[model samples]
Target: MSRIGGQLASRGCPHQVKGTTMTTQRETGTAAPHRVLILGAGYAGMAAVIQLAARTKGCEDMQVTLVNPQERFTERLRLHISATGQQVAEMNIPELLEGTDARFVRGWVTAVDADAKIVRIDDNRVLHYDTLVYGLGSVADTVTVPGVEEHAYTLNTAQDAEVLAERLARLDRGTVVVGGSGLTGVESAAEIAERYPGLNVVLLGRQEPGAAMSPKPKAYLQAALTRLGVQVRSGIEVVKVLPDSVELAGGESVAADVVLWTSGTRVSPLAAAAGLTVDEHGRIVTDATLRSVSHPDVYAVGDAAAIRQGFGVMHGTCQGGMPTGVHAAVSIVRALDGGQPKPFRFGYYHTPVSLGRHDAVVQFTHPDDSPRRVYLTGRVAARYKETVTASPWPTYGRMKKMPASGRYQRETYVGPWLPEPILTVGDTADDITNAESVSTAMLVVLETLSPLERAVFVLKEVFDFSHAEIAQAVERSETAVRQAAHRAREHVRARRPRFTADRSRQRDVTERFLAAATGGDINTLMELLSPDVTLWTDGGGKVRQALRPVVGAQTVAAWFAAIGKVTYQGVEPADMNAELVEINGGPGMVFSGLERIIATVTFDFDADGRITTIHNIANPDKLQAIAGGITRDVGTI
Candidate 1:
């Protein structure tokens, strides 16, 4: 029936091959072949190629080629472990692809031509592809910060980790400043403190460390750092990095022998240069289906894409990257087969932060950004982290041959539309609020309409397409498009009231809350807070904040009154501003003024308009987005 059948019949219908099979099958004297060019042999990219090769069993038309700079796939996720002098295992590309029908090309990609559907590798070689999957991962963002390029070292690659390990081994005792106290910072600090007990490990951030993490984990992190004798510095911005010291924004300087920069990440420049639609951080923008907005044949995955719904480009961890790769591959396969690509979806997972060798904190979060539930610390958490690190590889190995299941079948018809909506920084409109609000609005808009009506409304209203354009995009009749749009609008109007928030009332309530927080009046603070209010903070073990939720108005008032007694070297009580803003779908206040963003406060309301939960974003890393270049007057109030 097909060329694949003929080839299999000639080869005794064997599925397993002992060696590399390079035989190309021919069909009807015409080349109905499909060539997939996958870039970057990282976890996601490698998994994509392997899965494609296994699933296209009877497809004689498919050919896969994987391009990477190195011949071996180094476990990049374990760089922190490797940096701590642990022996990291390496996976050989050729050995791993022994039985697979994929070809590996060893060369660094210099340029990509999306329109031509070709990649220019080093040595001036051009490789063409019917479908191109981008999994270039990320590199250290070294721009903007002064003197960092010349002095600081990064733990981005395997080689970089090796260099760091070697440096640590040679050091007897000195100050090591770990910048940006995010997950990477925590891991690096823990590893360094454990490996070299003599060295003074200082974790520096703009806000308190572990502020973005859960309370239990934050407490665990602080305990681990204290136990390991690591110093934590918060609310200080790095003005300049020097050869032997780091200069802070408030004219303060810290002496350091080694500076490890684990700050934010930026997308690979190759994606933007290829004429792909990229965001401000150089991350390629993709539609709901994970296809590039500029090029239909090209797709971007992992740290390279800026998906809607979150800040900071969807955690650069392996968890996000792997799913993105799978989604991109599935979308490409479906598109190639003349079918509509399925939308990508993500759920929150546990975040494990290793504290040295045997201590860790595992923080679990819900899908709706709720405060963490399960908080595991010490040896148990360490073991869990290890298992998590090892689970993905074996799972990927198993997923290599998994057949592609059709669209996810649901028991109930929840409308034929993608759930989450994409959001950007400057996309403020009547319909847009924060990340969660945008996603909710999009879901509500789609859930109330039928399939055809949903498609027409999304194309015409949300995407701002013309009537003719809507018909062309969905391949529908003009009359059908008009009627669908009309019905969809009416349906949306009826269904929209449930999701709408009272912005005026929310802002007023937030301002009232702010007045109570800033006035230092315990009575006012008590009155503003609900009786059952729960507070959450992300200090990341860098700054001192509420370690646990201070429930009840009296307890919260006592906590606020205690703040007046504590004083920093230059900070004063009066130089703070708590402005009302919307965050995480609720009214919130951004606390900042004296050259630093102190905290972000969010309130959850009950049916009686009482606050149920008080969420605070004091994690300096999370606050870095709002922290601007302002000079603080260093004086007592």
Candidate 2:
């Protein structure tokens, strides 16, 4: 057990303090614990310590120490909410680390001596370590714009946020200028506008808020800001921040009583000062293993590390940051165990932004962080955003019990995953979608549409309902329904082509592809698939199927060919019975094992009769649609 107090004393110090150290243990011929010193207690730092501590709990040969400015874990994601006089939960970091083999030191990191392997705390105390996890994190840059450091406030810490909250509460009516139209600026402006209804909240930045999101969600975010009375001034720069106003690039001045600076990013210069290589932004430059390029003993993570991936240098984000911490912990463990650490790879998944308390927008992204066509808005998005924000604490708790839970297989899973698959099977041509019934592939595309848009599209396009009828059925304004219909149509038309294979041709193609896949004939499978064919598998995270969409004929063919040789879900290849059948007015295949439907595969083809897309649905809950038996006479194409 560790006997160190809030301030750690090291025997490595030339003066030889009263406390114990690894150097003393070595001199006495006793084995010393492998020490891992983690700096900061932010999202990244906490994740690294928790994962490492949990994994090393029963082992006495390892010790972990975490140093931070405060014991309370700051919810950086909700700092904007806190800045509006709203109360956030007080999460004690020590309490979370109580049962683990981890010690928490509450003090600001003053300096790091890389050569000595010692860290200097604000109180002049020193802590020594064998491996150092440099996750000091970053803060909002207040030194960039003139007078910003002296005049403008920033939400860099919990105290900083509370200071703004106190100031906002004291003001009866005034203008609050939020510099930087990024996500932080947008959330701040919205929160201030909602809480202080009398206050004129002006969001000033060069780019419009939600510019990184797609058009639909972007519009939704902008509309929510407008509803909250946030004055958005975009495409304009804040050259200088004054005591009572900000100077724009065009020499225009905007008056403000409270200036909240949420613009730019800056990391601590401790790494550079300690003789470690740093990037241009003062972030420690890390190799693929997340270890410092110059000093292999030091590992940098979070916003403080300039780690590069195939895409580019990773930007600061909680989504990406948490993973880096977990990866670093895993790497550290591997290295300590005499194994080489693997390279780190990550892909951005989604961007959830909150607008006030009830409204939000969630923009789905590709592995490369590019915006996908899917998004969510309004209260649903707000709930999703809230769930994501509150997940870290519980996630850490779960990690304490299950260390492997922190690991994410992002390299294999590179696409957006739906929580559940949509069942479009019906008994007749009079189904809601159309006379022919929408294929599961097309319905998958429609799943990307908003609830209102999907409703409008189905009513107007399938049932031939007029705009007035759709508006009344959906209880929406006619104009709004019209706009939704237009968007839905454009989205669908752009994704799904008007041409399709004939029923006989589709059946033949499905038969050929099934025979090739189940027979493990990769060459035949490739020949049967389009060069750009995409395979989307939905296991709902329950089954061990692919969570990502496998693209390219070669990759998909190889994947299916391998599946044919292995026993999956307790079913042997010899016991699996797959047959081509009519499903959703198209040719589909169902694989049954042990007299039960194990999975279903649907095919989508181009006009040339080449299989262009495949939807593999293995979700047990969604299999209810075809569990009993799919009627062959559902419809005639």
Candidate 3:
């Protein structure tokens, strides 16, 4: 028996392995062990590895191998930042596969033998496998754009980013034109504006900037670019590129020193060269399970696979990479076990854009391109974006350890039920307190109540309902609910401290909170959060989240700190206005400005003057009325 045959025999199969071809016996009592080989180490490839490893962890009958040229995973999304002189930490592939049983091979895959199930590498070695996963992400498509190949800088690799960053730092003053107004181009231009304020950044696009995004985000992006002194030129097509300037189709010349090309991406040449069914752009054509239509054993994902519409073919971006990887992995696992293949599904509800440092715009859209009701801008949205990006790795790490039952076996999960009528004053406990705080902040404000007064007043007046509702929901409340709500409000309004020790005295706490959260300042944020502060995000479970509440200032602070490390170029925090108003019964803050109310942070303070509860309202539907009224007012202004 050959190496492949022997491995299969161990899994109770009698198959003959001749080079890369497998010959099965007619009367075999078992099936051969499926061998899966994956290419690339980017998001899609890495995700495939994790899913496959988890699926075949304890199974000895399957073999999986991941091949990539690089040993580390490069965060493609943060390449713009690296190109603009911001240093980013490398995410190690080995670290990502800590306890996984997947094998990693470092080599450049030059050719694919799809029929023979063999991959030829640069080292002249052939790797034989039963199934192949093609996830060669993408490369800069600079060939079509004339002089762009020789002169323009690209944001494809880490080395490229470093080179561009050095060039940008040395330049004194000139127009830096970005040839692409898509997400990457807009993001790059925004980042450059923030870092090198002296340089004139111009963005050129064929369509209006942010055309694919919602109107709310489009407006916010335009405003943010203007605020950052970025000139946006839309409906312009580049005809010729010179050393000193770029000539448009109408023969208009724009003076430029540095030109960044982030317009488009093309599939790897390996796909077409391998004789697989490929699209015009050289992307391999894959089916619903991410398997190549030309070859059942061959799979393609990420930017390399051209999936048809209506069958869950996601084009580009990390959003598409994850699902493709998962599907490919599941396909491989099912093939190995001789089980039915599961169809691939892509889940995405919102597209988030980071504006430079602390600002962000999130646009929610339905699957059919229709605009959804949710649209968030400014600091609150920025924070939400940061939290989302950092959650996957940690969650993935934990999921690897869960039992087959899919629940934490250490403890039995209990549904929320009324235990007893405990007298809870205000929302002192972490869960109920945070929920109440957010509710208050969103409901309070009419001018009259100070920030603290507004928070307390709203919590007592609005949410202090029947004992059954309170007890069943929060697991506490009934005995002293009314008194607690009333006293919490009174305590906050009566003693108004000029400043909280958690925030810097020089800047207003609310302003700084908004600024830091938007700007991605995890350190400053940690300092601002009270010891018992809790950050609650209400995305209605439509988006990615922690699911559970993030408690304690240190823990929440650490989470934000991680966000600060992944610098999104253009996102920045905007000032939020707290108009004093009456809601429910008492006063609360009505966070509004820059067109609408992004969020309202309400607080419930303890008798000792420390903030015991804080709530952040991010549910767009819940705040629609307030936002609509504020938008109308801003339009009048």
Question: Each candidate's root-mean-square deviation in Å?
Answer: 26.4, 12.8, 19.8
> Residues 1-637, candidate 1, lDDT per residue (tens digit)?
1211122212111121123122322423434467889999787787677667655644555778899998877676678888878887876877777666788999989999888888999959999987899988887666667887788888777888989889888899899998888778878888888888899999998777678676756776887788888898878688899999999997989999999988777767888888999988888888877788998777787777887644324656676677777777666665655557777776556677788767777776664435454455665567667878876666555454332221122322222222211112222344333333343343545766766686567657654777775654334567877988999888876644332355555556667667665666678777666786666554544456656656777876666554444453235666554555544344566655455566666655544455555655564434432342211111110
Each prediction's whole-model lDDT (CA) = 0.66, 0.80, 0.62
**Superposed model 3: Cα runs more than 4 Å off:** 1-33, 309-313, 402-637
TM-score, prediction 3: 0.61
Better of 1 and 2 by TM-score: 2
lDDT of 2 by residue, 1-637 (tens): 0111111111112211124443566668775677899998888898899988866775556789999989989899989999988999999999999988899999999999999999999948999998999999999998778999999999988899999999999999889999999998998898889889999999988999999988878888898999998989889899999989999998999999999999998999888999999989999999999999989989998999998988899899999889889989988877776567789899998999998898788888887788887666665567678989999999888666555567766355334443222223343325423424456656667878976788678767765778876664444578988999999999987777444535667778888888898889999998888999998887766577776678999999998887679997889988887776666656677776765567778777788888888888786545533553423333333
User: Between prediction 1 and prediction 3, which has the larger TM-score?
Assistant: 3
Q: Rank the candidates by TM-score, best first.
A: 2, 3, 1
lDDT of 2: 0.80
Candidate that beats the other on lDDT, 2 or 3, i.e. the better one: 2
TM-score-superior candidate, 2 or 3: 2
Model 1, position 465: C-alpha lDDT score: 70
Whole-model alpha-carbon lDDT for candidate 1? 0.66
Cα RMSD, model 3: 19.8
